[model samples]
Target: MSATEYARAVAFGHAFARRQAVRTVDVPGGFAVLDDEFDQVHDLNRLIGTGPVTAGELIAAADTVFGTAGLAYRQLTMDGPTGTELVAGLTDAGYRADRELLMAYHGGELPEGVPVSVVEPATLLDPAERAWRAEAPGLADGTYRQLARQRLRRPAELTRRLAVLGADGTPRAWCELYLSPDDRVAQIEDLLTLPAYRGHGYGSALVAAGVAQARTAGCDLTFLRVEADDGPVGLYRRLGFEPLGEARQFHRAAGGT
Candidate 1:
């Protein structure tokens, strides 16, 4: 498998553990179980733990679970060479498909800030700072306070801090540096900038700040993801991050539209 593919798999496995607070167990026969409230079996490149062996078996079992709980499940994709039979099985079974991109960085020192001081994200949750983050383009979906509260409710099992680009009382950008329990690695999450503030270098500064913070926290490496077609790929590459892996994202709505 390619390095990119390998990195992507590791990233997903890392994120999956965070999102579900579960562990990926190494079962027999080159397979593993992502044991959440609903256990899923998959191989390296990712196939549902349908039967004991393949996607087909897993889907057959999934029907009952999804029906009974009204739960929507998705195929757990992995990285590297997976058998075509598994893809065919999922397609034949009507599983939805989508794609995601992964990136990683190593071997570079984060540039030191000359004018601005890198501070902890928790500081920004203060009322005025929260207002600034809420108005920030990337965080427009919700308030910074709301998101912080939601995150704090969880066991900080591997939660990253929310860092913002600020001078005086205003924030120019925002990003999160978090940890993954399964891999014990730090990762960049929720990197965002206000659309109007894009050209000033705040994005780079924010990422650098995140990396520096993670390193200070004793993390060995950092990871982040971006859309394959997005322009940030170039920016990230320039910052020493490279393609690590690829993934598929599947989503379905209540209305099924």
Candidate 2:
């Protein structure tokens, strides 16, 4: 697929991730998901799309939704002209921009001998919750449980979750793959290796399993997004993934309730 199409596919996958949230709304050029229960930027508030909406209009729309939700911060994905103007407008409005690389991997053979397994999204919840809590004990509260529950309800054919298990059958690493309906593109998302399992090839194994599943499902291209400073570029490259472009996220800190 061409670069622009690839980027859009990745964006679609992200929007699809929050399908269970009740507050997503369509705006002038795109859509937004607004919530007050979760601290995650994407979960609490997010604007998606890259159409030709004015900065003023975009800000006004975001303010309406975020204000009503009593949320001060909103994250936006930068894409087309509308994205550019929103970034400038949001900056002037006291928001900060964070950039990340969007990467893609065309289908190919995965490495051998790396054990990976595909599990139901529901099956991932218990172990994932435990792992997450182990890493961030402070966040092991009701809100986190609620978010985890929401994530377990996968959006129909559009998404799939894969995992690599430890000897005891606990998830060591996992990732989600989203396939476009036409089967032309897929996106690998939320790839994570538990802190205790990092560097044991579980991450690589999970990724390979995701790609293989996408290919078997008839997708020719796959994509993912990674933080600019998280430092996994080399790992993805070694797995035959390459940079397509960057997606910028703009965040506005929470304000008055």
Candidate 3:
């Protein structure tokens, strides 16, 4: 795909993630999402879209909204125009910036290997909830397990949650396949394997499963995002995901709240 088309596809995935938030509010040039249930900035808080707004104005708007919501940290997703202005603005405001690559899968045959089973979000709920409760506390503060329960209960129609189970039927790894409402594009999200099972083929199996499902659902394109420094970028590339573009995020930790 052309650069323009790739960018648009990534934008669609961003919009999808934003819409799934627990709450959203309009800001100056975009929206602020609140999802305190999950620990990640992409899940918990987001500032999207800046359009033609000045950097100062955008920061002021973020301060107002996040301050009112009592949230200390937030991630601002930067596009071409807004990114240039916000990098300077955020630097002056004492925030840090991180870059992540948005990747896309060109249509073709999927690699074959370990089989992945498609499961209802609810089927994995019990173990997933348990895993979150056991794992989230050490990872971050706040009610992660509670939020995870809420997330599992609120699966969107466009989203397909799949998993690989162990001998005892415990979930070993899982991923989500999200098809755009227009059905022209899809995204493979949250492809994760438990730490104990990292070296196994579960992650690759999950990706293959999601990609196959996306094609079956009539989506011609698929996409995902990875941190620039993350090791999984190599795995994704081996699975046919190519780097299309990059987005930067500016964040301030929650001390202000």
* Top TM-score hit: 3
Question: lDDT value for candidate 2?
Answer: 0.71
Return the lDDT, model 3, position 211.
79
Model 3 steric clash pairs: 72-254
How many residue pairs clash (N, CA or C atoms closer than 3 angstroms) in each of the candidate models, in the order given? 9, 0, 1
lDDT of 1 by residue, 1-257 (tens): 34744554465554554454333333222223233333221211132231234655545544443334344443354343345675666666666555556777765655555233444545445633454565554743334445443433223555555544455645556665666434546777666666666777777877787676667777666777677664488888888887766654332222322
TM-score each candidate: 0.60, 0.83, 0.84
True lDDT of residue 50, candidate 1: 17
**Residues 17-126, model 2: lDDT tens digits:** 45645567888877887655564535446776557776677678778777777666666776532256667877888777777787788545557677878778887787
After superposition, the stretches of candidate 1 with alpha carbons farther than 4 Å from their true spots are 1-68, 72-85, 88-96, 109-150, 165-170, 180-184, 255-257
Which ranges of candidate 3 are over 4 A from the true structure?
35-44, 81-85, 107-109, 123-141, 153-155
Q: lDDT of candidate 3?
A: 0.72
What lDDT is obtained when candidate 1 is compared to the true structure? 0.52
